[model samples]
Target: MSKSYDAARDVFAGWEVDTEAALTALSQIPISMHCWQGDDVVGFEKKTGSSGGGIQATGNHPGRARTPEELRADLEFAYSKIPGKHRLNLHAFYMDTDESPDRDEIEYRHFIPWVDWAKEQGLGLDFNPTFFAHAKADDNLTLSHPDAGIRDFWIEHGKRSREIAARMGEALGSAAVNNIWVPDGYKDIPVDRMAARQRLEASLDTMCAEKHDKAHMLDAVESKLFGIGVEACTVGSHEFYLGYAIKRGTLLCLDMGHFHPTENIADKLSSVALSVDELLLHVSRPMRWDSDHVILQDDSILQMAQELVFTGLLDRTHIGLDFFDATISRTAAWVIGSRNMQKALLRALLLPQDRLKEVEENLDWTTRLMLTEEARDLPFAAVWEEFCERNEVPAGLGLIDDLDAYQASVAGRG
Candidate 1:
């Protein structure tokens, strides 16, 4: 099999693509797997009414993980089927607790078990402050709420979440990316948009004023244009977060589904990278609006990987998956989305980037276009199969059978 990969390597070598270097690069890039996928975003937090805020996870899949043990089991299984080491993204609401603590009061103790488990699995952890799906967010506000008390509570939660993330990083010896995203916006026209934006800025400043060691945690802020309910405007627009990140020296999160339908977020990467120190990518598939659909091997994803590789920004970019499709197998969703991301990256790495750059730089537009089209017909499938073989996972459609067996094993349990 190594010789087989070597033979495929020869094909890549002809194009000045180092297959070994590409494989090594792909292996080093870590994709943060969202924890909500396993349980349909229904965290362990105690809540009375239906999920609030702008977020929603449709469908009622049968095999959804009902407990922490079950979710971790599903995550373990999903991670096993994918290549490369990865990180798990955890929302603060996904705490493993016997007694519920208010979001603001949550401490490092609630997530110690998760840190232990992640260490055992050789996986790093990323943290997010769950600004949605709570009574505090019933009015479609959190850090940006006009009410000072509500704003204060969420600010405390943000601080606590960051602390917990830092502790996890220190314990696991890998810096955890602590991300903040709030569903703060209006459904219709609002005369006081400035007030909300100002409140959000103040809250974020208060939360991020105290700095933690960068070796342990990196703080990032995410923005969205619109959502299911917030159709009119989103407080944390890309512009707002971009300015905030640059000024505050924080990482900016670029969620694939967070921009306008016609906008390609890949274009923003270079622009943002020029100012921001690092980036956190929430790789997702959006149907029309910000619908969190499972990712596929689509054009946008390919362009995203290419942009990252072409700009040579892979090391500074933190890749993470963000989607929940309750209509399909949760574990399979994890495997499919993560693997597709890896596939996109591998293809990007296998590209003759230097050759393409040379033609474009010299204004050889026709040759550049021809090369772009021709590169698609290269032996990408062969190289991908070799990656799967090297990773010891099922090659090609062989994963479907493995998924079927897993389904059978968990069929009767739920």
Candidate 2:
């Protein structure tokens, strides 16, 4: 260990916080890095379409991956810079195959390449059913569409996605979280909201009728507020999914940017943990809107990590990043976001939670507040640097030059 790390360790020891233990715990936790960032949500589909579901990757950044091979290479580079083992969160549309199959006709064979790649990289995989960027979703209504044919089409796609996810999980020996998020809502005030929700519920029932083993796959539902087109109402609101998750025994996905601007998802963690068996967090930074900016070590992320640690819900919560900033080096974006999340978790792990809870239980508000504020000034940087060294990744700005060299190499993609 470095001299700085040894000094920091002594400081933490005074507070009854074991620095070694914190680093070990942080290493065990894996952040599911989103693959959409590599290609700006433009999957390797032969018949490409618009990304119209309130999901837009702004900026014509150079060197965006044009093929699955390129994306995988970029992801490989990203994983190298980031500390600890991680998982890849893939969307259904990111299939790598020569066969042209519509969304509903997709099968596990189409994504065999991804599974093989993940095996080689020693990474787990997660999945999502893409419900946007197609002709059927042009109206921003999918499973809840008034037209029966359109709804059935989306329902079949969802079913196929689940099957694909199960295969991936079984192949990798980990439970792949198949999260479902749809852009089904209205732009203007609706005449009757009840019918749409009822239809959505019925469609979901049919889509999830075939149960897969929990060890191979887990179902999760993600809810969003109003989007670009659906400014009036989002069909799968948080309330709807929370209730559905509780009743159906599925994981509830809480996306940081999917809620109101003033709403803090950190506060909802403990409350929802009581009802849902597991949770899937889409950690993101929303700039004014659901801009999906790269996350930082901000208060929002810190409090979220603190909640998960304090409530003892870390085991049940799957951490996944959700952002696509095409404005910067895509690989650097992945590295920065993943490292920030790890830093937040490491900070949380080093907290004197037992003492804080003890003071709070005794109604000593002053000490509780003081200790919490004082904990912020701990020598977290030294400890973090040590962690990076141990993980064989660059610490601090050491990665900037490497990322710049990588950008130069890939600039020819234009």
List TM-scores for all candidates, in order: 0.98, 0.99
Off by over 4 Å in 2: 49-51
Instruction: For residues 1-414, write the lDDT of model 2, one tens digit per residue.
Output: 999999999999999999999999999999999999998898877884655566899887899999999999999999999889999999998999998899999999999999999999999999999998888899899999999999999999999999999999999999999999999899999998999999999999999999999999999999998899889999999999999999899999999999888889899999999899999999999976688999999999999999999999999999999999999989889999999999999999999999999999999999999999999899999999999999899976678888988988897896
**Per-residue CA lDDT of candidate 1, range 1-414, in tens?**
667676878888899999888888889999999999998888887653546566678897668888888889999999999988899999998999887798988999998889989989999999998888888898888899989999999999999999999999999999999999999888998899898999999999999888999999999999998876788888999999999999999999999998888899889899899998899999999997678899999999999999999998998999999999988888999999999999999999999999999999999999999989988877777777887888888866689998878867776665
Q: List the residue pairs that clash in candidate 1.
A: none
Model 2: worst 10 consecutive residues (lDDT sum): 45-54
Residue 304 deviation, candidate 2, in Å?
A: 0.3
The lDDT values for all models are 0.90, 0.93
